[model samples]
Target: MIDAEGLSIKIGAEAKEFDGEARFSRSQLTLWDRVTQMAIAAGEEAVQSAGLELGDEESLRAGAVVGTSMGGMHTLDENYDLIYRQGKSRIHPFTVPKLMPNAPASHLSMAFGARGPSWAVTTACASSNHAMGQAFQMVRSGALDVAITGGCESQLTFGVLKAWEGLRGMARDACRPFSKNRTGMVQGEGAAIIIFEKLERAIARGAPIWAEVVGFGASSDANDIVQPNQDGASRAMRAALQDAGLGAGEIGYINAHGTATAANDRTECAAIRHVFGEHADGLMVSSTKSMHGHCIGAAGALEMVATLGALRDGVIPPTINYDEPDPDCDLDVVPNEAREVEIEAALSNSFAFGGLNAVVAMRKWRGA
Candidate 1:
């Protein structure tokens, strides 16, 4: 669980500082914001796991796409505090570089010496899903052989927490998604990354395949800014199924965009029902948000990792704080405990506050 006490807020799930020494040299660390630092750490881990050490020429085709909704929040907050609160005239000269939305992605590309198609996406909560989706398409189109893609967010500042509190989404208790007693959402901050490569290349290199990315779907509601729409979500799921060429029955599990908010849990359930029909009753859907809290822009990447991990180990993580059931969100949430289930195919959903939606389809990876 990433959210715990002792944060600046009433409650939050925040990534702790590096357990050991810093990930990079002291001189290098001074230039990077926390978001960039997180992206570098996550991107390096993914590249290392893929067993990819690229030559100079080959690295040109390798790329990165990291997502962040609140890029360089820590840097911006600190600088603002220094200028306004402290009555200072001067600010850090590197402020512009540190606060750019693309800084994290740029850092990832430089860290891996990847020169192709490096970028960032900032779609509120669905940022990482869109970033990874685009990366998957690049690999499919043969634009790049290897890519580092995921998301990082560190928005636990006092100012941001106060802003969220104004929005009234902060849960008084725990984040009990799909539950009757659910109050609201809790914030979390962390990064999760994945490495994507061509299936043929991975097979030739004998790289371990954790899961196969079959399809990605995206949609925009163009409706309310904060409220979600069922039609848009259903459309994305339908498109993902079509892209994957899979029947609804083929999907056995779903990693839901369950925010523990009353609106999201109910709306997401309705979308699933509309898309899957009778199969919705049989599907196992759960929200890991109950454990990790809402990671905002990084939520999709973390949930995708969780979903793939579930597929690999045949262990579906649970919705931990489910005390009571809400009829509107009456999916089999795998409430309060982990379950052992071999899932053939799974879909991870990410629906953002702006009514933007993205979903990806994955299947359990066997051997080549």
Candidate 2:
């Protein structure tokens, strides 16, 4: 697993891991919702990385598309609790605005002057993948010169924790992806904002190219609401490869949507095998969710960054907490330690709960 710093699985307990007060200002911490604050913070870093001052010259030409599976859930629950549990008539003045799902994108737009197109996508875990895909398209089509695209999620509230617990996917302690002794998936909260720009523009400006988002593919299972379909997942990967103008043999690493759950790990690996054919055994696959936990809507974006690092640094992150291997997930899972390899291309897979599969293909930036 990519080093999560100190992220823990707070499934049954409180998410003491997130120190909101420490991260945001008093004004923002009090008024702006948690997810929005996260988005703003992430946007700040992302823009800084691109050496961009949005709306400076690219202000009107820049855009923001942040995604979240459950936007501002903490705000909604807290307000509801004050009125119902505390018998209070008055709630926070900015209740509706605070809890709005699109608030993150709106805040990012205002903060960074991304006036081109700002919206939020709420497609469960596939949210960020789809959002990034849209931004990539805009950049590729010359609709926007730059974009702040990613997702945020703050879903570790009491109500949300109970809901996850009810679903029975909450792991006992740590997440163990593709492990024979795996129990279930755990929940995590965070945001990741990625900067997207046209290749020519970035080249002209001489900005450091991190990785090339060559292609994105999406598909809907339309069959099961929760259970993942192998054919549908395989189709997304093939489409991503096709979109990137690459063949199966070019893929060296797969940042799998391995949620550590029995059904997901097996289904995803099997789907990869189906799509890549003989190349499956030669590919390295791992799930960083075993460290960061499943950050739900933010999973895709975070994994994308991790995969980009894999391409840039020539190091493939491992699937931590992996011990015994499940025969069903028999691919080389990189095991519990990191590996240094010169991989040219990687795939970040995100198969959401509703069978919404979004896959992105990226290659190491070797310059034009």
Residue lDDT tens for model 1, 174-236: 899999999889898888889888999889988978999999999999999999899999998
Q: What is the C-alpha lDDT of each candidate?
A: 0.87, 0.87
Model 2 over residues 84-148: C-alpha lDDT tens digits? 99999998788888888899999898888788878898889889998998888888888888889
Evaluate residue 45 in candidate 2 and report its C-alpha lDDT on the 0 to 100 scale. Answer: 88
Q: Where is the poorest 10-residue window by lDDT in model 1?
A: 1-10
Evaluate residue 267 in candidate 1 and report its C-alpha lDDT on the 0 to 100 scale.
93
Runs in model 2 lying further than 4 Å from the true structure:
1-18, 55-57
- Flag regions of model 1 displaced more than 4 Å: 1-9, 17-21
